[model samples]
Target: MKAQVLIRPKAGILDPQGIAVEQALPALGFGGVSNVRVGRLVELDVEDPEQLDAMCQKLLANPLIEDYEVLTSS
Candidate 1:
């Protein structure tokens, strides 16, 4: 099976990169863009579905600063 993980900064956490992007948007002529948050997408092949959470908890994401969602594709 193929598993995909979407990891992003938790609410109330300062996102410097996101802030920078949001600030630069208007200069680049991209308007009406608000609340631009940056995240990561990790795709991998897994033998067991249950191991996905463990992988995220251990290495894929930092639970304290970020939140993650797991998606499976066949």
Candidate 2:
């Protein structure tokens, strides 16, 4: 099975990368883009789909300031 993990900072958490991008967008000719948040995508092949969540919680995400979602594909 193929698994994808999407990891992102939790809401209300200060995101410096997101802030920097949001501030730079207007100067780069991109407008009206707000609430910009940066995240990570991890794609891998897993023998057990059931272990995906555990992977996210244990290592893939902080679980304190970050949240993760798992998607499995056949």
Q: TM-score, each model?
A: 0.94, 0.96
Question: Candidate 1 clashing pairs?
Answer: none
Could you give candidate 2's per-residue lDDT for residues 1-74 as a string of tens digits? 99899999999998999999999999999999999999999999999898888889889999999989998899
lDDT of 1 by residue, 50-70 (tens): 999999999999999999999
lDDT of 1 at 1: 98
Clashing pairs in 2: none
lDDT score, residue 72, model 2?
86
